[model samples]
Target: MKVALLYNQKPDLPENTPKYQSDEFAEWDNPETIDAVANALRERCDVVKIDCNPAYLQQIITTLLEEKPDICFNITEGIGEPSREAQIPALLDMMRLRYTASDPATLCLALDKARTKEILSYYQIPTPHFRVIHSLSEGMVFLNEHHQFPLIVKPLHEGSSKGIFERSVVYSVEELSRQLREVIEQYKQPALVEQFLSGREFTVALIGNGETLEVLPIIELLFDHLPKDSRKIYSYEAKWLWDDPENPVEVFKCPAPISKELADEIASLCKRAFRALRCRDWARIDVRLNEHGKPFIIEINPLPGILPNPDEHSCFPLAARTAGIDFNALINRVLDEALKRYNLAI
Candidate 1:
């Protein structure tokens, strides 16, 4: 089997890079992660690495055409456009190639958090009420209509906690306005203002499709273990800065010490969200409970991160590990699922 590992490698920025731009590549996979995925695929197939950097789009396409691998293991969190993550998949589709994860349409839909919420709403799935604010004036109008305090603001088209900070949770109109401006102006995207849920947060990872879709162990984010002054939500700092391999923050609890009934409910809710989004192969769905203890879909990540390091606290791999699937096994399993979907022998 020949497998093309499609990925965007994080660029090494200069030390003088601006603070705001430091996390510009947060969504892109590190070389360590890229190599890990390639190595895993190499175990069972002939692996070819293809960097999906937009700067070299022509070169990338030429390489793909030349290699013509049987399948592509896409993890390219593309650049620029709002539908960036779908770029590689769209290209693969144009090439009539089979790949892992969701289709281009689903990837594009999931990237826009507001659109995902609307689709979830249409399906009668529980998600927080949110409004997409394109400008400060529009945000003010939303704030006037919805007087919900303690709302969370985020970039409508970001993942991996990009542009999310502790200050994202606004308790006052002033805070909300500031965040809305930052997300709109700095991130160059619409701001998603959502009613903040104050309860336990959990992330669920799922694999396969339809009735065969298997939910891995649920992971509960222990915000209580965060710094004293930090907010309960999983901010970018909490994910990358505060937590590291040397001194890991005791944050996630796999298999989530919850009642079987509650676990079943969360699992079922996640499955519904996955199917609604038309996710394929594998995905990670974030869920947070309301003050009343009701779980609501936070967001759906069809292309979930798979940081090989156990200390990194990546939710998807952590959940898979708890379910007895190691890093390499998990990678191959996803490929196998994709193959099965394409009716190709593994």
Candidate 2:
């Protein structure tokens, strides 16, 4: 069997670009992660790495056509367009190629937080009340009406906490307006203003499909070590800059110390969200509890981040590790689940 590992290789920044802008654009897979995935698959099948950058897309298509791998382990987060994540899958569908993870439509739907929330709400799944703001002026109406003050604003079509910062959680209209404009100008997209859930926040990872789907252990975000004034969000800085392996801050607690009842409820909600979004193979769902201990779906990551380093604070791998699944086993498990979906597993 042959497996093609597809991933985004972030290109080098222009020399004249500012540091902050360059840092923001560096959201692609690092070499270590690509190598780790390749190494994992090398033990089970013939593996080749394919770059998913738009510039080299033709080369990728040609390579796949010639090689004809049995399956593609797709983790290609496209660089441009709102439906970037779905672009590669759509191409694969055009070429009649089998790939891992959710389908193109699900990937496109999951990328838009508002649309995901709409589907969740349609299925009667719990999610926070949110408003999509295209401009800063619309934020005034959101604040004036029957809305809450403590709202968290984010780019409607971004993941990996790209547009989310420490100031995302706003307490006043001024802050909301500022953050809303920032998201609009910086991300060039609508802002998702969600009613903040103050209760505990947790991330749930699941693998497989349908009746055989397995929900791994839950991971809770710890904010005790953050600055006194910092909000309890897993902001971009906290995710990428702050949490170091050697000088860790204990940012995540796996198998979050919760009662059986709450744990079951969270797992159920995660599974429901996964199915409702039509996710396949594996996914990571973020959830937060309300003041009354009711869990609400925050967002779904079908193509979850898999940073290779053990100390890199990647939630999906951490949850798997806590469940007694190592990196290699977890990688193969995802591949095996995809193979099962296509009836290609022997």
Candidate 3:
């Protein structure tokens, strides 16, 4: 089998870049992660690397045509635009090439938090009440009508905790306004102001498709491990800064110290979401409990991050490891699922 490993390598930011802009490449994979994925794919298949850099669009397209691999293991987060994550998948679609994970439309819809919530709501799935604030006036109007304290503000179109900080969980009108402005102005995107869920948070990883879909072990985020003064959120700082291979924070509990009933409920909820969104191959859904202990969909990541290092505390791999599927097996499993979907020999 031949596979093309498509990815966006994280670039170093220039000095003096604004704090808000520092996470521009946070969703992109680093050299270590890219190499890990390539090596894993190379273990079972002939692999070729294709950097999906927008600056070299023609070159990338030419390489894809020349290589003509049977399938692409896509992990490109893309650059700029609200539909960035969908760019590579859409290109693959145009070129009539098969790839792993969700289709372009699913990727685009998943990236837009508001739209994804709308779809979930349509399917009677529970998600926090949110308003997309395009400007300060819109946000102020929402605040006047809602007047809910402890709201979570985020960039409507970001993933991997980009544009999310500890201060994102606002407790007052003033804090909400500040975050709204920061996300709208600095991130250059509408702010998603959602009602905060104060209970425990969990991330669920699902692989395969339809009747054969398998939900990996659930992962609960232990916010108590965060700094004493910080809010309880898996913010950018918490995900990228405070937690590292060395001096790792004890922030995750796999198979989540929860009742079996609760675990089944979360698994069912994630499965419903995966089918509702028409996700193929695999995905990761984040869920958080409300004050009433009801699980609500936080966000859906059709293209979940797969950092190969066990010490990094990456949720998907951690969940897979707990299920007895090692990193290499997990990679090839996704490839097999995609191949089966395309009716191609693996």
TM-score for each predicted model, relative to the true structure: 0.95, 0.95, 0.95
Clashes of 2: 0
Indicate the TM-score of model 1: 0.95
Runs off by more than 4 Å, candidate 3:
12-22
Q: What's the TM for model 2?
A: 0.95
- For 1-346, candidate 1 gives per-residue lDDT tens digits of 9999999998888877743465667788889999999999989999999999999999989998999999999999998787888999999999988899999999999999999999999999999998889887887787667567889999998887888999999999889989999999998889998999999999999999978999999999998767899889989887767766677667999989999999999999999999999999999999999999999999999999899998777888899899999999999999999999999976
Per-residue lDDT for 215-237 in model 3, tens only?
99999999887789988889988
Per-residue error at 79 for model 2, in Å?
1.2
Candidate 1, position 271, lDDT: 96
Clash totals in order: 0, 0, 0
Q: Kindly list the per-residue Cα lDDT of model 2 for residues 68-134, writing each as its tens digit.
A: 9999999898867778889999999999999999998999998899999999999999999988998
Off by over 4 Å in 2: 12-24
TM-score of 3: 0.95
